[model samples]
Target: MISGPLDHFRSGYVAIVGLPNVGKSTLLNRLLSTHLAAVAPRPQTTRHRILGILNGPGFQAVFLDTPGLLQPKYALQQQMKRQIDLALKDADLVMLVLDASRPDPDRGQVPPMLSGRKVLAVLNKVDLVRDKSSLLSEVDRLNKEGAAEVFMVSALRGGGVEQLKAGVAALLPEGQAFYPPDAVADRPEKFFAAEFVREAVFNLYGEEIPYSTAVVVDEFKERPGRKDYILVTIYIERESQKAILIGRGGMAMKRAGSMARRQIEAFLGRPVYLELRVKVAEAWRNDIRFIRENVYGSDRPSGTA
Candidate 1:
């Protein structure tokens, strides 16, 4: 609880931008003190721009955890890049997260969109760094390159996160609060439900199964006095992939469903009856209509700038 005058109230969007596996989602979860975004080892795990709000006294920071920047190979990847573009357009400040353990520190280069914005270069995963001098050198190099400020922290271990939060709050411009203090995230429960299921698929499967798959919550019915019933359909590119997902005698599907159900239960704070089905959508990632409908959903209309 920070004490400040009404005139000093600050509220604005801070876009978290970075390359794949750079710990952007982990940093957001750490800042909000809740797991709003799904964390997995796989690249492009985050498909949408998730907004997490942090309110303290007179400040409210709307943090946008965006999809990792990468070269688009299909329509789905193009849409993912679009989401990042939108976040960049709406951001009041930008935080470029980088993997500090990498030998080449210059890889943390700022993107064209972030060129004139208030940028903070965050060197994440400092816990993995053994030499303190190398970390300082990396920070200094980033600072000299053009970042308004450079911060070193381990988002996974909660190290230097409090200081990062304080620094963000101080940099925000004075404005009205964008959301209620009690609100944690802007996305609905169903969006996270599908994400949890997709995460389970990524965790349970190997090879191309995770990348070639997408989870759609066909039905999410909540009963007042009973456990919630969620029906999800997993989309795959081929029948062979379907067999792999279902496994021998349906055991694989059962395991994945059980794991997803437990995750949903933990997230919703109630028991859930989850039903999963697999469907073949050949090269759906390259289909524009499917990408717009299933991936981005209706909230974000197609061709949005």
Candidate 2:
């Protein structure tokens, strides 16, 4: 969608809602043509609502990419659930993204929170489905499940994304753009720094290390005629986790920092000097106060964030 001087603009908030690890981040990146959301090979990689604005010719789609819906396992997970709920509350339409490569017994049922809003069931990863007959059957089944429409697309390869975006645009109410014409997102650069670092950790670590970590950007400075300086802290629940994350002589942390800095630089359209550190937050997943204070950057800080 191209943006020109618009006299009839269609704009609305579309919440990307789905189960854990359903490629919601990939779908968001595909829709916006930018890496506004973090992607990893794990559930719950997205913990916050990522708002990505797509300005087409006569439509402005404000996508609220939300945390996956799941049963809360701890305080941090509960907070994540709340973030998803808040996204649902503000959404004018909900796009239920699903992995077509996997079996979903609950595909027909919409969550209670989405009862009133319009829903569009998107069967992603269709490229992985070998049987064309089965894929069509699945679409027919989902269409019967009460979604306004069912779209088949491969978010990884950019297939069928244009049609889905068009379908989404046509449903929106006609109005002026919510954000500026040139704005891609409504967040500070520091926020995305933490997100890229978290994505790096999730990709590099394994065995509980990824889920046990929380990244917080302590200081972000933009220096003229110099690379951007970013100071980030990775909060873990135990000392053993910290040791694993840092590796021997800090090799693991160094690797993660280098990888994250490259991605951050690419996204920011400049150079970056990323410094990574680790701290033990001691069962922060279960500690509500600790999760709220450090993870969300609230008023309270016990020095671990």
Top-scoring candidate (TM-score): 1
All candidates' lDDT scores?
Answer: 0.85, 0.84
lDDT of 1 by residue, 1-305 (tens): 22234458889899999998889999999999887788888888888888889997668999999889999988889988988988888888898999888776356576676778899888899999899577776667667778887888999999988778877887788898988989888677888899888888877889999989988989999989988989999999888898999999999999999988888888888999999999999999999988778877745552211
**What lDDT score goes with residue 277 in model 2?**
84
Pairs in steric clash, model 1: none
lDDT of 1: 0.85
| TM-score, model 1 to reference | 0.94
Among all windows of 10 consecutive residues in model 1, the one with the lowest summed lDDT is 296-305
Model 1 error, position 220 (Å): 0.7
Question: Per-residue error at 168 for model 2, in Å?
Answer: 0.4
TM-score against native, each model: 0.94, 0.93
